[model samples]
Target: MNDEEQYSVWPHGTPVPAGWRSTGFSGDETTCLAHIDEVWTDLRPRGLREWLATRS
Candidate 1:
């Protein structure tokens, strides 16, 4: 995850990108993707969510 709350799968041994951190969940691609699907119920980015919140 990153400041935007987006999720993705990275290779186990590779360094995570500068802005992103691990969710501490590691597994095969299918499992990782399932985890993302389960947790990431809202697809909007952080900025969009915050902006929408202000509107509401």
Candidate 2:
């Protein structure tokens, strides 16, 4: 769930893979969309890439 009232750019419904980020957009809407694209560029699905990589 969205933790804040601000613009939340997290993938909903569909299962988001790991390494993906949940940016806290401040309700800018336009900027949020752009941010999403930027985030997507660097983000990869779970076990696909290392963004916030963790070792088990």
Candidate with top TM-score is: 1
**Candidate 1 ranges beyond 4 A from true positions:** none
Task: Give me the candidate number with maximum lDDT.
Answer: 1
lDDT of 2 by residue, 1-56 (tens): 12221223543454534544444344455776876566555444444444346542
For candidate 1, give the lDDT of residue 45: 97
Candidate 2 global TM-score: 0.33
Model 1 C-alpha lDDT per residue in residues 13-56, reported as the tens digit of each score: 99999999999999999999999999999989999999999998
lDDT of 2: 0.46
